[model samples]
Target: MGVGDVSKRILLGRKLRSSQLGETLLPKRIALPVFASDALSSVAYAPDEVFIMLGLAGASTYIWSWKIGLAVAVVMLTVVASYRQNVHAYPSGGGDYEVATVNLGQTAGVTVASALLVDYVLTVAVSVSSGVQNAAAAVPWISHHEVVVAVVLVLALAATNLRGVRESGAFFAVPTYCFMAGVLGMALVGALRASDGHLPDVESANFQIIPAPGYDGGNLTGLALIFLLARAFSSGCAALTGVEAISNGVPAFRKPKSRNAATTLLLLGTIAVTMLMSIIVLAHHMQIKYVDDVSRLRDEQGNPMPSGYDQPTVMAQISKAVFDNFTPGFYFVLAATGIILILAANTAFNGFPVLGSILARDGFMPRALGSRGDRLAYSNGILVLAFFACILIVAFDAQTTRLIQLYIVGVFVSFNLSQLGMIRHWTRHLKAETDPAARRRMHRSRMINTFGLGMTLTVFIIILLTKFLAGAWISILAMCAFYALMRGIRRHYDKVNLELAADEEDRFMPTKVHAVVLVSKLHKPTLRALAYAKATRPNVLEAVYVSADDATTKALVQEWDDRNLGVPLKVLYSPYREIVRPIVEYAIQIRKASPRGVVAVYIPEYVVGRWWEQLLHNQTALRLKGKLLFTPGVMVTSVPYQLESSQIARDRARRDSERVKAGDLRRGTVRSGGRVPPGKQVHR
Candidate 1:
């Protein structure tokens, strides 16, 4: 095996045969973390955002945190219910884009696709950014290097995901499960501690959160407080960003895709809500005073402690406060939370590529995205997602707080469109189905979708009203840009399709085929080309050679007579010693001389097995073929003559093909076609 093969085997594990893909199908336990990590990891930052927003009106407003949590939970449950219908209806895994495109019009579908695309990008940025911040809590060096750390983490996540969905999921499953267990365990411990009156106060409990300059007293009521609550609710809705991934990735599940996805969505929603509410309750009981600005949070002496002070993430603080001085608890919570946040990006990694593949298959994106990678993955889409996510990370400097404002906008956009689309989907389906039982089920599903639509529309309005001035517009703009680009791509493909259609006019034959053999010297290649041209029986046949030097041309003419060649030889002389330009001029002159005749240039090419041999030959032939291609009425044909070295390469390929044990083509198989020939130079 080559070094490349050896390295791949070590990294990707043993290759699985195409027939064994079913064996890699995820069971519910593994599937839970593989697809659910995004929603589950929201626990790491969602509570902090809730507390931060509420703290804007001072610590007393923290009383409203549970209410905001309830609102988010309602949205979460409604979305989950709605997506269960989505998976059942659109099991191809196009998610919102498919639903809107099929049920609504193309515009609506594009809108949903754009929203989902933006959301996927933000998912990576927010998840990795949050993970880095959490890690910075444990490692102070990472605090100052937040953006860099976050970017590296994003790249690492992208690489892991590039390995293929099942493999990536399996690698991250342990950390995801650990995070779920750790948070639930910590929440339970804190609840028990609160019940026993032995719960320790959070480290920040003593620090008072001074309200923003405009709100000094507790006198504010009516609309102002309502607006504040709405904004807080909007920010807290970041927890809902990954709710649709399971729906989007239904095909990744085993048979009965909808059932498996629905079950997984249920598990995701339950765990996410439980963890979210638990942390909020724990924070309230322990009086954890979270503020937006670190400046306002000060020591008793009223001195600014440090410029880049490392504040642990909200979940980290809760874990430390609840599991105070317990080393294992602290590290467990820290490790799991950080790891889960990083793995949360995996949801986007899986969903974006699958969706991209669907879009590409539909001709809405580049066709390359539809092609599977070595691991039978949509490698192009994965790389595209990673690139955009990396851009956002760099642009936002990896600040989770800033990125959070932009987080839920795209998700809510997709949620509203998908729910609305599902309503239409059921209405249309109901019109065709005659069974009463099926009708009744459709009606129930419609009710669920209708409720979801209402909830998501409300959340969408809240997000726009609250977050439009705060970075959310960026996501909106991004979605619009993606929509326009996808439409343009569709139009380009449509135009090409029209242009390439075979017509009666095209069916008419070419006026004539004027064949010419490009000869360097009277060798096997030149002789072979002349023979092939004669077989074509064109209207005209001639040997065309560029004379860079007179002696070579004279020797070639003399050899032609010595061999009694069949066709007439025509030589084009070049004063500047250029091979391509003179021949190009000669072909153009031939077309102008006899417009009814077509020019067919047959060039002889040498093929070698060793990489070095190619450089020694074919430079002139390649240039001659390229020049002939541009002239009107001309078609260039290459007749390749295999050298001894080429036989070696052919032999190597045969050996490699025979040695294919299992999944050699399915795993870690990068293309090796564009190799340079040994001992020769070639044009680019």
Candidate 2:
């Protein structure tokens, strides 16, 4: 194997055959972390957002933190329930896009796809950015380099995911579970301490929140108060961002895919809601003062917080307060939280690629995205997601607050539409069903989806009203751009399909084949091309050479005539010393002369084994082939003259093919005889 191949093998592991795709399927245990990490990790920042938004009206308004958390929880659970119907109905992993397309037509489906696509990109950005921001709490140095760290984390996640789903899942499972355990354990300890009247105050508890300009004194009652609450709720609703990923990834689950997926979704929603509320209640009880602006926090003496005072995340504060006696527990919680937040991007890494594959399969995306890489993963899709995510992280400076504003807009757009699609789905099914038992179940699902639609629609409107000017417009514009792009791709694919459709004219043979051999020297390759062109037995045969120098051209003609090659040679003299343009012009002239006939151009090309050797040969032939390919009725063929170096490439390919891969022995793909695979042969 070559260096590149060895490096790829080391990075991605051994390539698996198509049949081993089943081995990548996840059971419920693994699927939970793979698909639910985004939702579960949201607890780390969701409460902070709630507190930040409420802090706009000062600490007194912090009393509404748990209320906002409860509201988000209700919406989250409703979304989870609604999606249970989705997985059961559409287990093909299309998720919202599939539901919207099948029920609401192509436009709605494409819109949902666009929204989900943008949202998935934002998921990676916001999740990784938030993780880095939280990590900055413990490692103050990370704060100055957040953008660089976040970009690197995004790339690392992409590389891990490129290793295939099962392997990536197994790698991420530990951190995800540890995060859950750490947060829940911290919450449990906090609750116990509170019951025993021994809970300590968080670091920010003594700081007073200075309300924003408009909400001074926290006594505003009217549209201003309503708007403030709405903005806070919208920010809090960021928790619902990744709920649809599970439905989109149902196919990744093992047998009884839908059931296992539904169970996972339920668990995700329950755990996420519990953790979110726990954090909010604990922060409120401990009087944790989280804010977007550090200046908004004042000390007990009513002085602004000192400069360079690094504020810890709400989770970090809670962990410190809850585990104040056990220093390792505090660090463990912070470490787990930070790691899980980063791993949360894994959910998008899995969902986006699968969705991209589906979109590609449906012709809305480039076909390359539909293809599996050596590891059987959608490598193209993963790379694309990572790339766009890095751009966002850099553009926004990896500020979670800034990215979070643009985050949930796309998700809510998808959520509302997906829920609407599910409602229509159940309605459509009910029309064709006569069995009372099944009808009852359909009615129940429809009602659940109807409620879901109402809830999501309300949240969607709230998000638009509250966040449009706060960078949400950018996400909306992104979704619109994606929608138009996908539609344009579909139209292009359709136009190409229509144009390429075989017709009666396609059945007719060309009137005659005029064969022309391209030559630059009187050599064996030129003679071989002449022979191959003659073997075709065309109606007209000639050897054409572009003469950039008269002396060399005269010598070549003299040699050709001396050899009596049995074919006339036509020399086109170029004043500009251009070889490809003159040959292209000649081929086009021949094609124009006989529109109903075919012009066959045979060019001798050198096939070299070494990469550097390739640049040394085939330059003229490659350029000529490229130009002639666009000429109507012209056929370009490469007559390869293999050099001695090509033997090296052949040997390398043989060694690579004979090399044994993982699982080859167990799969019986390798020879069962005593003969070992090439690399495994023992030498005494």
The best candidate by TM-score is: 2
Question: In candidate 1, where is summed lDDT lowest over 10 consecutive residues?
Answer: 668-677
Model 2 — which ten-residue stretch has the worst lDDT?
675-684
- TM-score of model 2 vs. true structure: 0.97
Error (Å) of candidate 1 at residue 447 is 2.1
Error of 2 at 246 (Å): 0.9
Instruction: List where candidate 1 sits over 4 angstroms from the true fold.
Output: 13-18, 213-219, 432-436, 505-508, 521-524, 548-563, 575-577, 588-597, 609-633, 643-648, 654-684
Q: Write the per-residue lDDT of candidate 1 for residues 58-164, one digit (tens) a residue.
A: 88898899888988898888888889889888998888999998888888888888888889999999999899888888877886788888878887887777677
lDDT values for all models: 0.84, 0.91
